[model samples]
Target: MAILIDENSKVVVQGITGREGQFHALRNRDYGTKIVAGTRPGKGGEQVESIPIFNTVQEAIDETGANVALTFVPPAFAKDAVLEAAYADCQLIVCITEGIPAKDEAEMYNLIKNNTKSKLLGPNCPGLISPGKSNVGIMPHEITLPGNVGVVSRSGTLTYQAVHELTQLNIGQSTCIGIGGDPVPGMSFIDILKEYQEDEETNAIVMIGEIGGTAEEEAAEYIKNNITKPVVSYIAGVTAPPGKKMGHAGAIVSGNKGTAKAKMEALEEAGVLVVSNPTKIGKAVKEVI
Candidate 1:
């Protein structure tokens, strides 16, 4: 039982007419996603990649019964796209668009909680995928393998790196979720941790996190008290100078909180195996097993 999405899921691409949107839609379709419709305002009654297009999410859902939405809407209108999907009753909304304002995400989160019961994966996320099942975002499916270990990360590329390394060790993953590299994301480490903890197929977990967020600490606390699965973590931005930001826009540390050291301490204290080097992630997981 993979979390969020699998092979049977149906998806609608919001802003499917755009170049990026079309590109990913084609890629997702080729990857075996059940892409039934697309949403692009004023471009209704057309088709992209053979999937029907509509002016709004409501129309797309009404006509095609799409339960999942993968958003490629630009940063400025990304909030509206999410709200539209929520209104259309999409069970899961995966926002692949980046740079959405924090305030807008707060509003979108509120809307999801208040008006709709839909689970939002990200406002600035890579969405999600279950290898050999379904993929909705930008992850290349060829590198993934299906197995017992579950993975979740804040960085997209790091997620792949962890999965690739695990594969080299002949350790396939049940699922790999990239929750996004944003200051505020819809799905936190806690959220994914809870899902992974309950998922029967996931016997162990690997969390790939980076600097500049208290999310890892929060997940550490949860793992210490709640989760029973073997957990391994890798914290990026270790070599980053104090009070200095890293490459990713969300990679910034100021006070005592949100440092790689602080997160590592919390994770270590919580009984999570912490890796000191990025390249040693697979070896560390190997040690845990």
Candidate 2:
């Protein structure tokens, strides 16, 4: 019982003809995801890896009953692809394109909020994986195994690193979600946390956050008030200089706000076992569990 997707999800690729789209589509298919159809305007009737292609998302959904849309469109055209998927009523829309203008994300977010039932994952994210069940975006498939741990992270590589470490330690995960490092990403830590809290299959949780935004702080509050499961956290950018932007788009330290220390302190106060070092994430979770 994974959140967002499972074995029953029929997926459609929005930019199926492009290099990234086709590449990940094949990888996802090989990982046992149900790749039902794809959409490529002017390339309809053509196929990639034997998957049928349609000109529009509506046509693809109507023909294939695809409920999940994986988008690999360019930054400039990402919003339109997302809007098309939302308008097509795709239940889960995962956008892997990065560098989209913040305003465009905000606009698309509001449009989805007011008009559709679509739940968007990322505009600059690694996407989610339900190990041994389904793979959605760009994360490596072999690093995860099915277990009771639930992972949610804002950084893609960090998500992978943590999952790899957990797998190495024989602590498999129920779901691993990368919520993206964009300022206005589709999903939040609290959103994923709530889902994990309610999921019967999940026994523990691992939260990977970075310096920047009050997201981790808000999630800490929610955990303090609501969650009872064991939680271990790792916050990056502890050694980062203030007022400087790090690798991720949202990873910047400002004056007295969004600091790694502050986030770590908040999690600590919330009864979360906070790991100061990234490499020790798996060990920390093991201790808590």
Instruction: Give the candidate number with the greatest lDDT.
Output: 2
Which sections of candidate 1 miss by over 4 Å? 247-249
Q: For model 2, where is the 10-residue window of minimal lDDT?
A: 247-256
Clash number for candidate 1: 0
User: What TM-score do all the candidates reach, one by one?
Assistant: 0.96, 0.98
Q: Model-by-model lDDT, in order?
A: 0.88, 0.93
Please provide, for model 1 over 7-77, each residue's C-alpha lDDT reduced to its tens digit, 9 standing for 90 to 100.
87889999899999999999989888899999999889999868999998888888888999999999999
lDDT of 2 by residue, 1-289 (tens): 9788889999999898999999999999999999999998899999998999999999999999999999999999999999999998999999999999999999999899899988999989999999988999999989999999999999999999999999999999999999999978987899899999999899999999999989999999999999999999999988889988786768878876799999999999999999978789889888988
Instruction: Give candidates' CA RMSD values in order.
Output: 1.3, 0.9
TM-score of 1: 0.96
